[model samples]
Target: MPAPASAPAPAPPSPHPLRTRPFRLLFAGRTLSLLGDAAIPAALALAVQEATGSTAALALVLACSMVPKLLLLPLGGVMGDRFDARTIALAMDLVRCVTQLVVGVQLLGGTPSLAVIASVEVIGGAAGAFATPTAAPLVRGTVPEAGLQRANAAMAVAHSASRVGGPALAGALIFTVGPGWAFVLDAASFAVSAALLCAVRIARVERPAPGARPSVLTDLREGWREVRTRDWYWSSLIGHSAWNGAAAVLMTLGPGIAVHRLGGGAAWVALLQTGAIGLLLGSLVADRVSPRRPVLTANIGLATYALPLLLLAAGAPAVVVIGAYGLAQAGLGFLTPVWETAVQRAVPEHALARVTSYDWLLSFAAMPLGYALAPLAASTWGPGVPLTVAALVVAACCLGSALLPGVRRFTGGPDPVAPAGAEAVSLPGTR
Candidate 1:
């Protein structure tokens, strides 16, 4: 008998994802783009206050930017699914570049009216709706399955760093030059991002031939089907929305508690900075963490948010609140990359963007509601009551989601069972 064949040599370990030129371009472009995007809140708030002065006017301008983005997200999902996602993303970058450039030039020339500012912001925000959902597909297209977690974690780190750096950058520019220059820099950032995108070569996802293409309504139906069919997906989304709503309450109340009970503005600033740092650390660690049930583990991590809320409700010392808040933010940071990678792996490439849009829409819609309701709840029952309630809600929702049958066992691939005759959708090696 022939000697038993020796086991084949193991395949060489894949190179670090960043070592790949395409992912490197993608990583750099998104980081720079997010840095610019992060600068917006601070710079825009100041610019609006100077231009309009009234808090109500400022709120209206901000709402104008947000509401359209939310309203058009479904359509954005369809566009991402229907077209070449990279091209759509690139075009949106150009559109935003033009819009931001126009806004910046106008601001520099003189204070544009609230109407003018709001109008331009609507255009920019609408572009963002289309742009946002394309991200997962782009990552999946550009990186190997083995690298997905690392790629996402790397991006998450960039995001957390940008959240810190962007505000500081904006503040410096606003003080030295003007807020107008910040927007100009943002526009320049988008232009650079677009150029980088022009160089990226994403794997083509096969689309239906033109003659057989589905209608937008059909696409929407299919996307919904994809979501509703996955008990894990829809259930997790509901839990995530609850988490968002509860977090909003904490955000709405934390500053006041910090300033009045803990210390002063410095206390709140320190807490924010600590949270940002925790986010950076958590993102760094996410790539190394592999759990048997990733979705369940991530939700368990998310439930930690309750600790900070409970601390705040008790009027804990600044140091205590700072520690709790940092821990909670770290949980959030870990959840971000792990959750993104899980969804990318589980969902079919054809409908990934659409599914993600639903993820964005529901989770985001809850936030404004939470913000609006938190004050009312506090006014009626006191801040402690709301904060305590938020803590319970967050913990319950996240833990409940984690316990859901589908999520508890999910291993980042298609459901093992499929409808009769339909092929199960899955990424190789994911299961």
Candidate 2:
């Protein structure tokens, strides 16, 4: 009977080191950090609007915040890949703390000049560019490959929780103590996060072998090469770029549609955000159930985003609109962890920051364009028309990415056991 090949040695158990204390601390720090981050935008927006009474000025402030991220993200990624992520993250947090403290002080005194506010935002954004790419690699380094999905999922939950809670808190604070106090709160959160991170001990890995210290340009070139060679990477990137681009347009126009055409206002916006929060919850649950094949699942979740947008275009009521939005958010939440896990599994730890930065740069490149074009397009064709187009674009991107051969067939992580007739390529920088 040939002993039935002994079931291929049971594929060895996944090495997910979930019980590690440092990982738990790291996760707590991320949760607190993101919670503070989520509060900043809303608080800042309210502060600017109250001070300037100009939506255009508020928009400019937001733009300043985002523009640096788009410009400096790749460089930030390089930094993460080259240095200790723990150190980078701690330093960035400190920078953010100082920026927030300045804003809080100014707000408490009086409305500061727009230039000062914009400068602070720009600095914060630049700091964020350095912080984000480090986050994934730090998590990867803390846990085994088997735990990547769970770790990513835990981070996502923190992000979602922040997204869910931050605005509500900001709104409350803005109404009660005023925007400056909210900024103060954000500063405190960053302080807490920095302290937590300081307490967690991380074992540093040696730098890549001596000759492997490629120049920055060379490293960028290699990172680009790695991405281009992977069908899954390119396909997903293209899809998300299209999806986010269209979503940006929808975000700018949705308010007008709800207020003018649908006769809803702040209530509708709240509903939309609430839906996204619900989706985050659903995603957290999905991650706990299974860690395998996150790419395919993410693709599926992304496709679901189109549905709510389409329903909104079709003139759904506030409840239906909110429900659809929630569903999309949930789907996006599920997609996030899968994508993060895939990146960790495929990219070398040494090069992870660079690759992640590249990914963010390309993925977000279209956001500013979308935000800029939405108003112009709405003026010409009316708001509903542009929103409908955005919905269609999102649907098309999701479906198109799913059709990519590599994306469809991808399973999560590397093989735990050696496969027949395959030479194992050691992870990048490993001897």
Candidate 3:
């Protein structure tokens, strides 16, 4: 009797994602873009005030920027899947660069007209709608599967740091050189980001068989089908949307509570600063752990957010509220990178952007609605009522999602029953 052949050895782990050239380029480009993104809110607000000086005008400009992104995200997702994600992202960077340049030059010349500001914002918003969905695919193309979580954690750290520093940078520029200069610097960041992206080399994805592609509507349907069939993914989206809505409620009410019940604006500022620190630390920690059930773990982590809301509803001391808020933000920080890594690992590469766009759309859709309704609810029933309700909704949705079989069984490897027609692209230097 012949001995059975020994099983083949497993492949050795790849080097850290940051050590790879492609990932480095992608990371640099994305970090620059994120910093610019962080600066935009403050710069835009100042520009609107200096030019139009109306709160309504400010709101309108923000709406102009936001609504288009929400409406066009699905379209962007399709484009990302159909075309080269790197190219699409690079093009959008250039488009946004030009838009910011236009705004900067106008502000430099003196008060630009409201029409000019609004129009540029519209263009930027539309471009962002298309660009946002490409990110997951880009990361998938750059980093190997083994290092995905680390890559995401590094990106989250950049985001956390930017949240702390970007606004301060904007304020410094705005006060010393003027808001025009801030916009110009932001434009320059985009230009630099575009250059970095241009240097990034990704493997060429094979196009689908000729006429294998379907109409735009059909593509949309396919993306929807992909999302609907995944029980874990859709359930997580529900929990995430509830989390966003509840956070909005907190934001709307927290300020008033801090002012009237706590000390004042300083207390709110302390809370924000503490939360930012917690997020930074959480990002650091997320890189260290490997959860067996990624979706369930992330959702349970997200449930920590309910603690702060409950504390606020109970009229806890300012120190207590602030500590809970920081802990909550830390939970979010841990959840985000893990969730993103899980999605990247499990979802098919071909439809990644399209599926993620649905994730983005639904996760964000509730925020504005929450912002609008929270105040109304509070006015009618008092702040405590809405706060308490928001807390319960967040806790319920997160914990309930965790209990689902699909979510529990998800180990953040490839999907066991991935749909037909899913394609995996080959990349160099990692896998």
RMSD after CA superposition, every candidate: 2.2, 4.1, 2.6
Better of 1 and 3 by TM-score: 1
lDDT score at residue 375, model 2, on the 0-100 scale: 93
Q: After superposing candidate 3 on the true structure, give the runs of residues whose Cα lies further than 4 Å from its correct spot.
A: 1-13, 420-431
* TM-score of every model versus the real structure: 0.95, 0.89, 0.95
Q: What ordering of candidates by lDDT runs from best to worst?
A: 3, 1, 2
lDDT of 2 by residue, 2-105 (tens): 55545455577654444777788888877877777777777888788877999999988988888999989988987897788889999998889999999999
lDDT per residue as tens, model 1, 390-427: 88988888888866689888987656764232243443
Q: After superposing candidate 2 on the true structure, give the runs of residues whose Cα lies further than 4 Å from its correct spot.
A: 1-18, 209-212, 415-431
Alpha-carbon local distance difference test for all models:
0.86, 0.77, 0.87
lDDT of 3 at 300: 90
Question: lDDT, candidate 3, residue 221?
Answer: 88
Candidate 1, residue 112: lDDT: 65
Specify the poorest-scoring 10-residue window by lDDT in model 3. 422-431
Residue 146's lDDT within candidate 1 is: 84
Candidate 2, backbone clash total = 2
